[model samples]
Target: MDSGLGEGSSGYSTMDDYESLISTTDAELLKRAWRNEKAAPQILRYEAALVQRSREQIKLMEETVEEFTSSGVDPLTVSLYQMDLDRTLFLLRSYLRVRLQKIEKYMFHIRKTTELWNHLSRAEQNFAERCIEDMEQHMQQSVLSKLPSSYKSHLKQSSSSEEDDMVPEPKLDTYVICRSKKFLGAFQLDDRQFLSIQCHLLSWRMNSFIFLMSMNFWTVLKTLLTLKLMIYTLYLISL
Candidate 1:
């Protein structure tokens, strides 16, 4: 059972480092399990391997504690090792238990059809059926018996209302006019209004230009009158 738990340098003296290693291994296994449901047997084998490893680790920790006691090591160091060992055992057991729980929950779906049941070995089929039976019994005794009548009724009412609620059709106002007769009429109206605005602007600009030209004409006339008066005055002075 190559659990894929890495046998790296066993020189990690701290609980944190050991936890990191275990967490990494557990994450990889979980990823694999999630990726393929058919790999349940492999997952179970890996879990068993981890359990074995945990047992070995606990034994080793015990021996280490014994050695430290005889060798005058600090009591705190021994207690730390014991704590780490206990934590490791707890995590390993929890990991295995969770996997088993998932297996039990999904056992029915895993072997729902005869074809699927036939594909499994006798032992696998038996194990799956056993899990199903156990789960069914547990649910009947613990979950179904504990459910309140009001909660069940509410659930039924909610489901019935959800089924009854038909999606309403969109209102006419929500529709956009793209290429209908109404759209063409609206576009023509808008075009006419835009043309009217343009005509008004052009008319105003032309009036302004005419007013400026008239002002220039008046200025030129006034200058010519002054020049003519100067010429007449010079003529009078010569006479």
Candidate 2:
């Protein structure tokens, strides 16, 4: 008699454990474990296709502008590629952000339902992680393109410019996220991480306005002081 089925069942405990293990890898199990709206393979494929087309268009624009004669991947053409890549990346990243937000909510429900930390099977987790990693890699490429050529890393897969790419490229910082429920503020756990909040950090227009206002105020103050000085000089001359 197995205790799993209350002393009367034979292999129920063993069967239960096996079922738990199988669910992680099984597509149906993954569907149940996944928090967000069921994302179809077709949707992911469609996103990939759009990204590919954007890349091709940029490459074509670059080639056409140069009549395909340029030996070097023109930096201008690279800019076009970087922009399209950035746009796609931004869209995908936003989607992931929304998903992550929802995950926190699903996590509580999943906790009550599943005994596992990683609810899905290892294979499924790996596949999802790979997709995330691909997005991160494209982001890295986008960052590198925007940076000065000298700042681009000499990766193992880099084409042809190993010699010029020699002068040690600058490294972007890694990110570490620390989830704190009590603090209620989302922030990087470590300063070592690169933050995507640069745009949100400060208002450029506000800073520019302050800079211009100060310049104008100083000019007016100087003009008023000069007029006062001239008036005093005339009085002194009259005396």
Candidate 3:
């Protein structure tokens, strides 16, 4: 199987070099970003630079397609370019939509957690803030207004509650498939256990193991979803 790495390349290079070799196109980078976003249970750091470049490229492609149409380019050729543009647009939109869904599901948890809050882009932060406001208002008017003051706080179950136990959090203890370009032998999982990353395959079974995501695994990172995750990702794709 061709890994898309250069032909006859051997020995490990630096992570930067490896990533550069594989992600030679904006479309490839965007595809990887979309996969990583959809696979992870939690919201990831926004791919601001990649998003910007994709948008710019999409705009240029749109203009090029328009030019081709006006200049009487072959119908088949113009349609191909249009199809490529549509795919990129779909990826960008799908990536943003996934983040929105995660935000809506875990807005309270993400807002209170500084680390997660920092992962959102400014536009996403604004959207989350508005979502929180709307949710609080809806709850206040529809139900919380009739409840006792002790139970009115949305973040907590009751006045006596010591923490925001009502807030939903991401399930970190889930499996996600990660692929690595480099051949790794006996990759250590812990002091007592080890795993292999050969043939570009890995089944990482927790967000806690994300620390092992270094440069080699960074190249062409994509996920193979479990059954539950497959359904979830399919739902996102359908949107």
Every candidate's lDDT: 0.40, 0.33, 0.68
Candidate 2, 107-158: lDDT as tens digits: 3332233332253334334544554456447756877677665555534234
Candidate 3 C-alpha lDDT tens digits along 126-193? 99999999999999999999999999998899999998989998655343344443333223332222
The 10-residue segment of model 3 with minimum total lDDT is 230-239
What TM-score does each of the candidates earn? 0.32, 0.21, 0.73
* Candidate 1: pairs in clash: none
Clashing pairs in 3: none
Candidate 2 ranges with C-alpha deviation above 4 Å:
1-71, 111-239
* Candidate 2 lowest-lDDT run of ten: 230-239
**How close to the true structure is residue 159 of candidate 1, measured as C-alpha lDDT?**
35
Best by TM-score: 3
Q: Rank the candidates by TM-score, best first.
A: 3, 1, 2
lDDT of 3: 0.68
How much does candidate 1 score in TM-score? Answer: 0.32
Residue 220 CA displacement from its true place in model 3, Å: 17
Q: Residue by residue across 102-135, what tens digits does model 1's lDDT show? A: 4455465455545445544455567878877776
